[model samples]
Target: MTVLVFLDPAFADGRIVDAGKPALMATDQGATRGDGIFESMLAVDGKPRKIHRHLDRLASSAQSLELTIPEPEVWQRAIATALAAFADDGGGGAAGGGGGGAAGGAEAVVKLVVTRGVEGSSAPTAWVQVSLPPEAGRLQRENGIDVLLLDRGYDSTVAERAPWLLLGAKTLSYAVNMAALRHAHSNGADDVIFTSSDGRVLEGPTSSVLLAHAEGEGGTRVRRLITPALDSGILPGTSQSALFGAAKAAGWELGYGPLVPEDLFDADAVWLISSIRLLAPVNHIDGREIGTSDVRAALTAELNELIAAT
Candidate 1:
């Protein structure tokens, strides 16, 4: 059961719409030209996770596209309405207010979307969609995934040199990203890690790239988490930032990188992290295994605990 709530001025608490009916205008820019921004967040039980971060990123993306959207409070109310509707429709199983990992609770995907409204209207069409998450993401989070390194066809410094490229924004123009994923699937790979034309690691099609390093043993053990530099034309990951904070509090060292494929190959473990998928361990990259299975499992379990706490 999917729920849709439109942010309308006439309705203070947002207007719930029929998800099965045609709700959007055919001329809407989001569908016609893919001119919009969106944020996908996880909703465990009946509450959204990392909501403020998602809203902040949505605002940044709107600003980047010069698209004016509803304020955060408006979006919040609509989100509430949507979640309540989803619950009423039996989509939100039991009310477990704990973290996302809580058993016997619904784990849904909440998507916030804003599109430049009909051609010349100057108003933006916005809505909140609540639905069940894909089972494949949960499976990959547990069983891990095989990835391929694909060139993103741009240099690492492109975002800095060309601000118009909107590399940091999470816009609806995801044709290239989807195409890359399809290519990976065709090649018998489960996912993709994008590399810049200059051979620098960027990110995944829909996630962030993270690599880990561990050394020594027992009391002398040191564990470090590293991700590609934000300036390297990749979307800022809310989950990665949240996990970094939690990991740091747990004594894990953290670093940013201008990383390369060789760095990934040399790391103790690699993962693709995102809000919906959480952390998906990368078992192999370009057909080469990343670290040993035992190390990957240990690190994955450790980090999953930190995520659960969040």
Candidate 2:
């Protein structure tokens, strides 16, 4: 079951609506023009993870779209109401929040959405959705996935030259992203890692690209995690940022890059990280195996532990 909570000014805790009924107007720009912003987060045992970070990104997206939304505190209250309702309705029963992945804990996916509302209405339609994450995400996290590297049709400099592209903002416009995933699926791949037209490794359709390198042996070993630079027109990954912090505290080095596919191939291991899927190891990319199975399993376990702490 899904829980819906509309952020109405008339209600201090948000207005709960029936999910089975029609709540959105047909003319809402979010539905018609994909003009809006959204953030999806993981809630474990009724507590949201990285909520502040998600809210901050939501605010940034709103600024980019020039669309006003309810304040962070308002969103927080609505999230609470939604999660409570979802649990009470039995949506949060025995299944853990790991989305059925290796993380395994009581979990729910919480989505915050705001649209331009009906044409000319001026008031944005905003709401929170609480529900179970797809089992496919969990399965991908467990068994790993095969990916295709596809050109995104834009150079890394596109974000700087075209601010209107909203490259840095997580908006409702995702037709291209979804199409890329479908293309990967049609080609016998489980997912996609988009590359810039200029050959820089960007990110996945709904995740962030991360590569790791290990040097030395035994006591002298050094492990480092790296991700593409934010200036490369990719959405900032909250999960990656949180993992980097946890990893660093555990003595793992960190770095950012203008990486290419070769970097992925050269790394000891690579993964596509996100809020819902968590950290899914990429077993192969474009038919080439990533790191050896032993190495990948080791690194994945180490990182999963760090993620659990986060």
Candidate 3:
């Protein structure tokens, strides 16, 4: 089941629409040209996780695109309305095994979208969608995944030189991104981590690249977290950012990098993280095993605890 809520000034709490009906126009730029920005968030027990972070990123993207969007409060109200509708019996009989919006099993994927609007129209189209989180993401988080490295066809510094590329924004234009994933699937891999033309590690098609390092066996161990630099033409992951804060508080050293494939190969553990998926360990890269499974599992568990707390 799914729910849709449109942000409208006339409706103080936002307007809940029929998810089954056609809500968007065929000529809408978002539908025709993918001229929009979006953010996917996780809501558990009716509470959205890292909402501020997601909103901030969305605002940043909108600003970069010079597209006017609804205020944060409007989006918040729409999100609440959508979630409530999703929990209602009309949408689905409770989210999961747990009661509607219950803490244990009830979880939803909340998506916020803002389009450039119908061609030549003055108003932009914005809405909130709520649905169940994918079971595949949960499986990947638990059982791990296999990734293939693919070139993103641009230099790492290109975004800095050409702001028109919109590399840092999380927009609705994801054709090539989806194509990359299909390519990985055809090659018997679960996902793709893009590298720059210069061989600098970038990010996954729909996630951020994360590598961990650990030393000193059990008790006195020192663990460090590393991710590619934000300026490396990759979308800044809300989950990865939140996890870094939590990990740092728990004594994990952190580093940002202009990392390369060799760095991923040498890390203690590797993962592809995003808002919806949370965290999924990378067990193999191009058929080459990464780190030790024991170490990877241990670190994954430790970090997942941190993610849950977030």
Candidate 3 lDDT, 101-197, residue by residue in tens: 2123467889999999999897999999998877788778878999999999999999999988999999999999999999999999999999999
TM-score, structure 1 vs. true: 0.97
- Per-residue lDDT, model 3, residue 242, is 93
TM-score of each: 0.97, 0.98, 0.96
* Per-candidate RMSD, Å: 2.0, 1.2, 2.1
* Candidate 2 structure quality by residue, lDDT tens digits, 204-253: 99999999988888889999999999999999999999999999999999
Q: What is the alpha-carbon lDDT for the whole of candidate 3?
A: 0.89
Ranking by TM-score: 2, 1, 3
Per-residue lDDT value at 17 in model 2 = 100
Flag regions of model 2 displaced more than 4 Å.
Answer: 96-100
User: Top TM-score: which candidate number?
Assistant: 2
List the candidate 3 regions with Cα displacement exceeding 4 Å.
Answer: 90-104
Identify the superior model by TM-score, candidate 2 or candidate 3.
2
- Per-residue lDDT over 66-86 for candidate 1, one digit per residue giving the tens place of the 0 to 100 score: 988999999999999999998
Candidate 2, after superposition: displacement of residue 87 in Å?
Answer: 0.2
